[model samples]
Target: MHQPGTVSSSLHEHVQIGDTLLISAPAGMFTLDTTRTNPVAFIAGGIGLTPLLSMLQTVVKQQPERSAQLVYAVRDHHFHAFAEELQQLAAQNPAISHTIFYENGTEEDIEQKHCDYVGRITEAWLQQHIPADAEVYVCGPRPFMQAMISILLRKGITMENIHYEVFGPALAFSVD
Candidate 1:
């Protein structure tokens, strides 16, 4: 989380190398279905890149023939997570197409080859780049996810084809 809470802060500050923290088993419907071979587009905002990155890496290793596009949006070049891992995965897999968006990036970010784009991902850009038939997976803050869902809907993407997950309380599916 951007601002760690008490528990998270304690873990970060004092957890030892051999710490055995007990946790509940992972449970979520937001998992990727590796059975389908359709093209996939992953849209992430800030730290939301975590889950999508796992799925992207899986596709690269298991479904080598599958086409995958990762559109990652962060506050700036500094906030971009998994840069090296992403680059290595993309370099090894020709089917993986990755684009990083730096909302607060500058010419230096682009000049330094830190980001491919320097703004939020928009409807126009998605339409021009992502295939309509591609299965889309989105993970981000509530507002970012809402905007992405709205844009995907407006772009004629069915709800069944668009998948997303957000932290904290559940979000109502209403989109304006």
Candidate 2:
């Protein structure tokens, strides 16, 4: 769960096993581009994985030929949600590759969590993992998205190939 003030936490705490709840429909311009066939690279942090997971699931069902990789970063091993399902999906599907990173994890933690990498996700690490020319989709904290975007730009990834979405409250910073 995220925390007290976050959407994920609120839903987790209030929602019951058999309870029915009403919610607004999903509405967001940030979404996967199904037309692109060049391969997809999903970089998600914390709860941002939700939307990307949906996209990945769609890719598996609708376009199984598409090659996709997911790089996920979470606070720790125990805190990662839907981990077992993600790992199993990756293991069973040849078209998908999944890697998990823990920001505050030890080697033991990595082993226990069944995650691939430790520490925070880095641009260099991403470069080595994702396929070249893969279309990138990033969603995470503001600092993470900003950092990843900067690194991606430095690596010569065109603006057209990179997409992003922000969750929670936005930070105040002048674009100019």
Candidate 3:
């Protein structure tokens, strides 16, 4: 997890090879419509990458005709997980596109092509990069998801076409 909390951190610190951890089946409302052939765009922030990445992989493997776009934001390289796997997927699949944003990117990171953009994601950047007609799935911190949803709505994307999962308490937004 990118932003580990008390439970996750404790598990990481204390779990052993033979640890019998109780896990439940995955559940969430933010689901991908694999049956649709529309282009898929994923907007992820920090630890939110996990679910979105799974969807991306499924799309790549099961629906080769569908195009996928990933816009990932993280604190920096250290927090950027699945870097190699992402690169490999994009490299092997011409229909897949990956863009990464680093909040604390160094000059070397950009010069060496480690990140696509520096600084936090913005509404303008999202509008310019992500296709408005694409089916969008977003997962991120509460505030990030809120802002992304608001922006997508304002960009003329119907609420039904945008799906998101927030990490914290549920937040309500005023849809125009």
Best candidate according to lDDT: 1
Query: TM-score for each prediction?
Result: 0.86, 0.79, 0.84
Residue range 118-139, candidate 3, lDDT tens digits: 9988989888977878999989
**Model 3 TM-score, all chains together:** 0.84
Shift of residue 104 alpha carbon in model 3, Å: 0.8
Q: What is candidate 1's lDDT per residue for 1-176, written digit by digit as tens?
A: 44633666778888999989876543336888899898999999988999999999889988999999999999996788999999999999899999999999988899998999888898899888888888899998878888888988888889888888866655566877
Per-residue error at 176 for model 1, in Å?
A: 2.4
Number of the top TM-score candidate: 1
Candidate 3 minimal-lDDT segment of 10 residues: 167-176
Error of 3 at 126 (Å): 1.2
Ten residues in sequence with the least summed lDDT for candidate 1: 1-10
| Global lDDT scores for all candidate models | 0.87, 0.78, 0.86
Model 2 residue pairs with clashes: none
